[model samples]
Target: MSHILEWKTRLYLFEEDGTTKARATLDTGTTTLTGHGAAHRNPADTDVPEIGDELAAGRALRDLGSQLLDIAERDVESVGARSGERTDPVLGWSL
Candidate 1:
């Protein structure tokens, strides 16, 4: 069966003192996760707010993606456990 679901996300960016910070949040009704990122500009370099915003936002998204993957991996790891069976420290068979 095909399933359709929606996840709402909000991203906020802040800049001050040549530094940009980003926060990304995802809410799935029952669960909420947040990712954070920051970027700093060197005094020698030109102040580019857009570049900082992009970098910080990208990092936050990457963090969020990693969190989701970790959750999925943990969920998958549990599928191998059965009654009175211990979960394997290493997932799947080592080839």
Candidate 2:
């Protein structure tokens, strides 16, 4: 089965009031899913824009990944119910 498809995702980050915020959006043509995250700078800590950006972006992407997995799990259950929790055969771990 050749299912040649492409999904595009866009991530945006911004800093405001000593906080760095990030938004990750996945565009699948039919619908869009978004995840948000933020990192706050402590008043006593050193100000590092890069660190904040990295943290915020990583968190946003992590959130987005979780949402994507939930969608897949739901879709799988809709068409054909699973006897039990899904697991990766090779890894022998729960999915």
Top candidate, metric TM-score:
2
The sequence of per-residue lDDT tens digits that candidate 1 reaches over residues 15-36 is 9999999999999878899999
Please tell me which predicted candidate would have the highest lDDT against the true structure: 2
TM-score of 2: 0.85
CA lDDT of each prediction against the hidden true structure: 0.83, 0.85
Candidate 2: segments with Cα more than 4 A from true spot: 83-94
Model 2: per-residue Cα lDDT over 1-95, one tens digit each = 88887899999999998899999999998889999989999989999899999999999999998998788777666766563455542233255
Off by over 4 Å in 1: 81-95
